[model samples]
Target: MIPTRIAVIQGDPRARVDLAVGALAPRLISRDAARAHIALAAAGMILLGGDDVHVDVSVGAGCLLEIEDVGGTIAYRADGRRSSWTMEVHVAEGATLLWRGLPFVATDGADVERRTTLHLATGATAVIRETLVLGRHGESGGRLASSFVAGDADGPLLVEQLDLDGLAPEPGVLGAHRVLDSVIALGFEPETTRGDLVLEHSGAIARHLGAETHTSRLDRVWDEWVKRARQRTASHVDKPANEAAVGGN
Candidate 1:
């Protein structure tokens, strides 16, 4: 059994969840009242051969949503067929969404395809983090193709595709590496002394292609972006109250 899809939409002041779940689908573990969002926990044995999963998320104007996964996701050995995972996200003007994704591991004989698309309106913000690991401890992994596209109301901000196979020697791509970790930040740009790939649009992307231990290369950038995002959200949340107080005075 595999989970087909999970959708989350922002209501007046909270987020609503709709699940199309199977026996092996991830379950909602906890909800944060202050954040007005919920967390998801993966269930027993997930993502076997021919498994397909989709997640859709929308944040209404002026709202905030946060999503996190409990642990890493493993793709078991697939004889021939492949497993697919897709995620689509939409953020309205003045809204924000933060997603903390766990690592994805592909064991030997596994084939997987992962895609992510994000659309943001003017004044909206989004932060997404992802890590892909080819194999487990000492073994070489299988094949994985990952695609990501993010844009705002005006036009596309970033478009990228990464193809990786443990059987192939990629001197130009990974070059003796097994991990690809990245973070995408939209509607906010931070200055960094280190090298970071700056997109054509307003946001920026930080990526590291090396061993799993080097995944922390983007930690500083991620931390700065998250801090700024939280501050922005706090100010937005207090605006209405501040206005009301001024009116009363």
Candidate 2:
């Protein structure tokens, strides 16, 4: 059989809500799901038997938007064969975008590569969080390679690169840990208040993660926060590479 590829693109209208996709279709969250202008679009994207998946997004001027996933995204590890996923985002001035990506979990022994790039214009605000998990609890077979780059109109701002050879452990990377996640949020500069909101609201995020893991409870909620920071190799306040930083993590 063959795999299906999806593309999506979004643009901002007069008041906001301008989002689109290239090939992938999105499931919008119920208006009752959240507050004004905020929308959650997620889909269970499958990597077909013989194809890859790609997603693209754009935000127009004077718009405020938020994108999130319904749940963790599972990736099937291909043996020596390769599979990939890519996301490209563009943000215009006076516009705001919050992209909360779900976790990516690789199957054992599967070979996979994924990349995400974001471009932002001056006065354009955005926050993005990406999480990747090496392997599931007990399953293991293939390899996972991933990279991310974010920049604005001026130059580069943030970059993350990772490579794992096999199901086997990487000394400093994953070590023996099978599951890992990363969250990166940008913007919150002039406002400054948003960063604090994230910290206070992070309790829900921590509790949610605790619920997800279930069995082994973390001694301190703040511990998970630190782990996520290490995985992405970005400070709490740093959004992609294009914008100037404002606060501390």
Best by lDDT: 1
* Local accuracy of candidate 1 as per-residue lDDT tens digits, 1-249: 444444444443334545554422434432221233435556556668888777767676666666677777888888898998788788888777878787888888889998999989988888888888898888699888899998887888888898988888477988898888888888877564567777777777788887774546777767778777767678444433211111011
Candidate 2 structure quality by residue, lDDT tens digits, 1-249: 122222222321112233343234453331111111223333345542233666666666544445666566666745456777777778666555666666676766566778888777776555565566655665653566788777777676566688875446678776655554444444332122222233321112221221123332322333444343223323211332222121110
Worst 10 residues of 1 by lDDT: 240-249
After aligning candidate 2 to the native by TM-score, how far in Å is the CA of 59 from where it should be? 1.0
TM-scores, one per candidate: 0.83, 0.63
lDDT of each: 0.71, 0.49
Error of 1 at 136 (Å): 0.5
TM-score of 1: 0.83
